[model samples]
Target: MDLRQLRYFVAVAETRHFGRAAERLHMAQSPLSQAIRQLESQVGATLFERTTRRVDLTPAGTSLLEDARRILAGVEDARRRVEQVAAGTEGVVTVGATDLAAYRLLPRLA
Candidate 1:
């Protein structure tokens, strides 16, 4: 439903074990499991088929996995772009120079 929950879902989906997913996320297992449950409830579908040994994605989970990954990647890209702008490292730079000056100077700058 949210980024955090989606992240949690991806972790569990990738690892196929709640404990391992929790370890990968550096959180306690209980909260990770709760988050996955909450995510499933919010989505109105059972996302994972869980057994004592491992977890497997249901059809709905498989469908969401791809979208969740794309959404997270987009969020990260936006965050990076925002940081670049904040740091004055983003956008275009235009320089004006005479033809000869550009021929002489641009190579050295490059």
Candidate 2:
């Protein structure tokens, strides 16, 4: 439901261990568990199967993971594009010249 939750989910999915995921996220394990619980509630589906030994993704969780990846990628792309535009190097540039001009002018320009 939130970016934090998505990030938390990704960490859990990657490590398949709550304690490890929490350490990687630099947060307490309880909050990470709570966030995952809240996300499951928000989506009306369990995201992970938990046991004393390990954690695994549920079917719903696997599906959501794909969507989460796409969403994160889009957000990253938007940020990059915005940064590039702000730096004045984001748009298309067109160069035109005749073959004869290329033989003469291109060398000079170079």
Candidate 2 lDDT over 1-110, as tens digits, reads 98888989999999999999999999999999999999999999999999999999999999999999888889899999999988989887678999998999988987
Model 2 TM-score, 2 decimals:
0.81
Segments of candidate 1 deviating more than 4 angstroms: 92-110
Local accuracy by lDDT, each model: 0.94, 0.94
In terms of TM-score, which candidate is strongest? Answer: 1
Worst 10 residues of 2 by lDDT: 86-95
Full-model lDDT, candidate 2: 0.94
Error of 2 at 93 (Å): 7.3
Following a full C-alpha superposition, what root-mean-square deviation does model 1 have from the true structure?
3.5
Report the C-alpha lDDT of model 1 over 28-91, residue by residue, as the tens digit: 9999999999999999999999988879999999999999999999999999999998898997
Each prediction's number of clashing residue pairs = 0, 0
